[model samples]
Target: MTISRWKPNVTVAAVIEQNGKFLLIEEHTAQGLRLNTPAGHLDPGESPIEGCVRETLEETAHAFTPTALIGIYMARSSHRTGNKEDVTYMRFAFAGELGAREAGRALDEGIVRTVWMTADEIRASVSRHRSPLLLQCIEDYLAGKRYPLDLIHVDESVR
Candidate 1:
């Protein structure tokens, strides 16, 4: 018998804040209404922080300046994309400031709108979150979890 090794997919999330409210994207999913931070898969050639910044801008049409990393989260589940299978995700979350909103960039497909909500409001809407990490990241940020931007270092040759 052979045991197959499991590989968890990596994702990066951004938590942008303004005046004590968080920026969340409302997106339509097969499961109905869902809310999530500006986040997505870590594309090739981008570090977690860079990916977070990119995802935020893509999903929110706003510039994001990641000040600190929150924490990492891991989740596992089963779903059928066309066939039933187990899936896992490792998420890197960051808390930071949002720069000015761009004029012409469109929000990513499936994104309904962006909203600002307090942490308490987020906690109340837990059932509508796309993933548990949504609230976890917010809570962690509120708990004062912050890491220096210099923590992520990539060589210039990698660019």
Candidate 2:
């Protein structure tokens, strides 16, 4: 008998909407070019909120201050380059203020560009989305779904 430990890949995403548009990244993925919100895997020694801020900056070259959590979601995907194992992702989605892009800062590697799209445009282009959660998060934001930032408590030990 073998004991197994299962852990989902925890990640954070920033749902940055401003002036009737939502900020998204057009990046190259295993599935080819795809659009996604500013999102990435949470790093060690950082809380989910901090991870969101970092990911938003890295992907969009902009500062973000998360105000509310949109939701937490889990999904299984099989997109590894050469692996057949399905990976489960646990994502914490946040909505907040997106600052101006940093001058002379380069977008993260694999990110082609940053673009703003209206909800209608996003809905129409679901086929190009990197993940199903991308549109879900945006729609949730538009639907006024927001949870207090304190909803998830990160112990000091985790930070």
Candidate 3:
């Protein structure tokens, strides 16, 4: 019997807060319309921080500068159908500043719109969230948990 190595899919997310609300993306998914933070998979040759910044821009049409690492999260999903396999995602979530939106830029594919919601509002819409991490990241941010950006080390070789 041959053993297969398990590798979790690595992703990055931006936990952007303005006023008393957090930024979230509304997109179409197999499970239907769902809300998530500005997030996506890490791309080749990009640091996690860079990936988070890029994803935030692509999904929300706003520039993001990550200042602090909110938290790292891991979750498993068996609901994905096409691949017929269980998958785990390792997410690096960052707290950041959101800059001006690019004029007339369309959001990423499948993204219907961007919305801001208060923590209490988010808590009330748990059933509409794409993943539980969306809320976990926000709660962590609310609790004042943050790590310096220096905590992540990207090797020069990756560039």
Off by over 4 Å in 1: 1-4, 80-82, 155-159
Best by lDDT: 3
Better model by TM-score: candidate 1 vs candidate 3: 3
**lDDT by residue for model 1 (1-159), tens:** 999997899999998777889999999976787999999999888888889989999999999988888988998867665678677989999988889999999999999999999998999999899888899999999889998877778787666
> Which runs of model 3 end up more than 4 angstroms from their true locations?
1-3, 80-83
lDDT tens per residue, model 3, 99-135: 9999998999999999999999999999999878999
Q: Largest TM-score belongs to which candidate?
A: 3
Q: What's the CA RMSD for each of the models?
A: 2.3, 1.3, 1.3
Winner by lDDT between candidate 2 and candidate 1: 2
TM-scores for every predicted model? 0.89, 0.95, 0.96
C-alpha-based local distance difference test score of model 1: 0.89
- Residue 96 in model 2: shift from native, Å? 0.2
Please give the lDDT score at residue 5 for candidate 1.
Answer: 91
